[model samples]
Target: MRILLVLFLLAVGCAGRDDGEGVSTQRERDSVVGASNLPGASGVRGALRAADSANARHGRLDSAGP
Candidate 1:
């Protein structure tokens, strides 16, 4: 009875603690560029432009292939 109560309390405490592995440092997070970093329609346009530029560059290389 008391042993079961103690076990339950231990489990509850452990579940709420962060083991530190899930946390990201400021520098680590800053190095990532995700969609959340961009704001509205302009962000979408910027992403499309970058994709198009990459595709054009790839096409140029492929055209020169053996």
Candidate 2:
């Protein structure tokens, strides 16, 4: 039937729209990479170091007696 044909076409068309923008942004990432390579990487390394410190602090707190 024509109704079934239209419904099938609609379903197929809708299914292809979720392909996640269909392009790799990595190829365009060269410009920003050098910026992150600068002195101390502008707190990026510090941020990761802070994560470990925070986890350690939380572990200490969790183990302390009330």
How far residue 7's Cα lies from its native spot in candidate 2, in Å, is 18
Per-model TM-score on C-alpha atoms: 0.39, 0.38
| Model 2: per-residue Cα lDDT over 17-66, one tens digit each | 56577654642343244357676555655565576799999999999969
Most TM-score-accurate candidate: 1
Clashing pairs in 2: none
Compared with the true structure, the alpha-carbon lDDT of candidate 2 equals 0.67
Q: Least lDDT summed over 10 consecutive residues: which range in candidate 2?
A: 26-35
lDDT string, candidate 1, 16-48, tens digits:
666678888653443343335555646555666
